[model samples]
Target: MPRETLFTKIVAREIPADIVYEDDLCLAFRDIAPQAPTHVLVVPKEPVESIDSLTADHQELAGHMMLVCKKVAAAEGLSAGYRVVINNGKDGGQSVDHLHFHVLGGKSLKWPPG
Candidate 1:
């Protein structure tokens, strides 16, 4: 219905990504314009614009994303701690239209997040 986002390109392998994790449910890869030392994006294979577009059928999908984030974060040696962020819309600072979660760690993260 709309033009594909950069993330969509990654999903289709039209663009290269430093993929950290992937499964039938979703895909996880390093952010090109990384905000933190350890910045990764976990995105669902089935396109959803944002969390606002999530429906009842997406509940399990959402949970799976979190579990994957957790496993990947630990694997990345961010066992100390990490932040999982979802920027839902333009005002929420979502640069990409695809629904994805940012996992940031490897340094102290100050709150009142920017």
Candidate 2:
């Protein structure tokens, strides 16, 4: 079945994206709408809808995404610090339907990110 999300389209190569990293299980791409100097989206190839839907089977993928986030941050020279975010629902400011982890860094990030 077709994945019901923009991220799915990106993963399926149906949409153009500046990909930074890719593996058998996931892909990391630059966020078209960047919030920081080094903003990237790390996502799994699976059709997970959101973080809330993650299960035991997704544990390894989730960990892989975190490792990828760290690797990307280091590559982007964000050694000081960084933020990893996953917007859960509409109220959480998630516009995309697929599960994704946002890696934000390369500058002093403010507290209480909006």
What is the clash count of model 2? 0
The predictions' CA RMSDs to the true structure, in order, are 0.9, 1.3
On TM-score, the leading prediction is: 1
lDDT of 1 at 79: 82
Question: Which residue window of length 10 is worst by lDDT in model 2?
Answer: 1-10
Error of 2 at 63 (Å): 1.1
Instruction: Assess candidate 2 and give its TM-score to the true structure.
Output: 0.93
RMSD of 1: 0.9
Taking all chains together, each candidate's TM-score versus the true structure is 0.96, 0.93
What's the true lDDT of residue 53 in model 1?
A: 89
Model 1 per-residue lDDT tens digits across residues 1-114: 546888889999999999999999999999998888999999999888899989999999999999999988998999889999999889999888889999999999999897
Each prediction's Cα lDDT score? 0.93, 0.90
